[model samples]
Target: MDSSFKGILYPTRLPSFGRFPAPPQVHHLVSWFWIPEWDIAPGRSSRQHLIAFAACNLVVQHDGVELSGPTTRASHQDLSGKGWAVGALLRPAAVPSFTSRPADLRDGRLMIDAPDLLAHVVEVMGKETTARGAEAAAVFAAWLLERVPQVGQEALLANAMAESISNNPDLVRIADVAQQLSVSTRTLQRLAVKYVGLSPSALIRRRRLQEAANQVRTHPGLELAALATQFGYADQAHLANDFQRFLGFTPSSYQKSLTAPL
Candidate 1:
C-alpha cells in the first residue's frame, strides 16, 4: 500500500512500522501484514491508538502469540522498552476458520498457547526477534501456509460478503448486503455474528466509521456534509453522532486535531 493510505486508520506513531502484502496463497484470507518495532527511552512509555477495523488479527509478540477478535471500537496498545511484533490482519470472513466462533472472541484477546500454533512460526522466525523485515515476512508467510488451516465454502462466501461491505462506502444497511448476497437479512445477521464477531448492522456501521475516519485523516479539508452523504450517513448530524460515539470526537473536532500543531 502507498504511504498515504498506510496510516489511514491510525494516528501517526511508532517511527519504525511497516505494512506488507500477504503472500499470494494467503491473500484471500489475510488483508495485509504489519510489523511494529518500538524503542522507548527509560522511564518513558508510549501508547498507540488505532481506530479498529472489522477484522481479526494474529499478533505475534516476543513472548507469545495472541488472536484478537474484531473490535467494535478503537483500541489502545501500550509500548515500553524494546520490542517487535508481527501482525496478520485477517479478513473479516476468515475469523471462523481459525477460531470456533467469532462472537466468543469479540472485544477480547485469545492467548494461543497451543504449541501447534507457534511451533512452526517460531522455527521460521529463528531465535531472533529483531530479524530483517523481508526475511521475517517470508517466514511469517511460510508459517501461515503450514499452520493456518484451509477454510471452506462458507468462509469463502463470507469473504465475498465482507469484501463487498468493506469496499463499498455506500453500504449502509444490513439489508443491502443481504439483498446483494441473495440471502435474507436474518441469515446475514446470523452469519455476521457467528463468524465475523459482529452483528451485520454493527459491521456495516464499523466499516462506515472507518471510512469516515480515513477520509478525515487523509482529507482534512473535506466537507462533513459531503462526506456523510458519500458514505451513506443520513446527514452531517448523523455522521457527527457516529464519530463521537465510536471515535470519541466529532468530525470537525477530529479534523482540527489532525491539523493542530504537534
Candidate 2:
C-alpha cells in the first residue's frame, strides 16, 4: 500500500495499483493517471472500496472507454480475473469536453466512444517487457492533450476552485473556498455544478471526510472528539454522523476493522 492512499479505504485488498503524475502538458486537464492490473485465481475476488474523489474519471479498459461522473457516496468494484485498466482522474477543466450536465451523471458512468484513445492505451499496456507506468500514462496524457487542446479561463477557474477545496483543510465552508478563489458563493456553486457534478459544500465535506478517515486509519489511537475538532466537525457526534452517513460505519467500527484478523 502507498502512503498517498487518501481515497482508498482498504489498501490491503488492492491488486497491482499504481498512480502516476500526469505530464505537464495535461496538467490543466488531468490530476493523475491510475493503473490497476490484477490476476485472481479461480473462485476468488478482490473488492476495492473507495470514498472516491468528488470528480469525474476517464477510464480505459480492454473492452472500451467510459466517463465516470462524480460520486455522491462510497463506491466499490469487485475484480475477479486477469485484467488491467488505465484511468485518468480528470480535472474540472476537462469535464465539459465529455459531458454538458455533470450533475445529471452523479454516481453514474457514461460509456464513451473513444476508440482511438482506447486502442493506444491498450497497445501501450500490452507490451510485456516495457515499463507500463510512465509509458501508459504518457500515452493517456497525450490523448487528453489532443482531445482538449485549449482550456478556457472559466474552466481554469473551476480547476482552481476544485484544487483549493481539495487541498485546503481550513476551507470547511463554501464561503471559505469562494473567498480564497476570489469568487462569489453563487458563482462557486454554479462552477461546482457545471464542472464537478456536486455543490461546493459537497466537495468540502468529501475532502474533510476523506482526511478524517485517513487519519483514523493511520492513527488508530487518536481520540474521536479531538479528531472531529481538528477536521472542523462540530463535535464527536457530528463526525460519527458523517462516517455513518457516507461510509456506512462509525469511526470506531472502521478503526476496529483495520485491526481485525484476516
Candidate 3:
C-alpha cells in the first residue's frame, strides 16, 4: 500500500540528550535514546521525524521508573539504558512519554484515536528492521508521513470507520458518526463498505475492542471497576468478559502481565 501517512515521513534528529552510542542488535525503527525529560513541547519534537511511528519500541529504562501513564511517576535514578518501550503504529492522542493529557500530542485524541491506518507501514518497519539496520528507524518515519496509504481512498475511509468504533464502542451507530463528521450516514456507510472490507459498524467495533486491550493495562489507579467504566462496561464482570474475548486475559490478569518480570 502507499504507506505515506503510516511510515517514516519526515527528517529526524536527536534532541540534546545524552550521547550514548547505539546498542548492539539495535534495529532502526526505534531511534536512539529518546530520553524522557528532554523537555519537548506539545508538537512533534524536531527529532520526531527520525522515529518510525508505525513501529513499536520495547523500551527498557536505564534506570527504573514507576510510570503510571504520562504524569503519574516516582523517582528513579538515572534512567539511562533501560531500553523498554512499546511503540504504536498509530498517531496517538496522548502526549508522549514525558507529558500528561492527550492534548499533549496534537489535539489530544480520544482513547480510540489511532485506527489501523498505520498497519501497513508498521509491517514495512518490521521488514526493514534488519535490511536498513540502524537507518530503518529514520527511514520508516519518512515513509509514513510522505503519502497516504497505497489504497489511499480505501485506507482513509477505513480509518474513519475504525475511529467511529473508538468513540463509543457499544452505542456507536452510523448516524452518530454522520453527526460527528457532518456527513450523511449513508455516505459514511457506503465509503466504509466499499473500501474497508467491512461495514462501518463492524470496523468500529473492532477498533474499540483492540484499543481497549492496551488501554486496560495502562492505568494503575484504574482498578477493575474504574477501567470497566472508562471503556463503557456495565461493571467489572462485563469488562472482564469482553477483555478475555479480545485479549485472552481478564482485566486483572492483563494488569498483572505488565508488572510481571521477564
What TM-score fits each model?
Answer: 0.87, 0.97, 0.40
Q: Highest TM-score among the candidates is held by which one? A: 2
Clashing pairs in 1: none
List model 1 lDDT by residue over 1-262, tens digit each. 1233432444576647877888888876788778777889988887776776677888887678888988877777888998778788887555765687877887798887646545545564455555566566666666666665587777777777888787776667887888888888887877777668888787788777777788878887799999999888789999999988876779898788776764
- Give the TM-score comparing model 3 with the true structure, all chains together: 0.40
Please provide, for model 3 over 1-262, each residue's C-alpha lDDT reduced to its tens digit, 9 standing for 90 to 100. Answer: 2222222212122222221223322212112323222334554333322112211122322222221221111112222322222232332211132233322322112232222323433343345233323333333334333322233444444445445554455544667777776678787776554433235655444444444444543445566786667666678898777656633557687567556653
Error of 2 at 36 (Å): 1.1
Worst 10 residues of 3 by lDDT: 66-75
Ranking by TM-score: 2, 1, 3
**lDDT by candidate, in order shown:** 0.75, 0.91, 0.38
Alpha-carbon runs more than 4 Å astray in model 3: 1-171
- State candidate 2's TM-score: 0.97
Span of ten consecutive residues with least summed lDDT in model 1: 1-10
RMSD of each: 2.8, 1.4, 16.5
Candidate 1 yields a Cα-based lDDT of 0.75
Which one wins on lDDT? 2
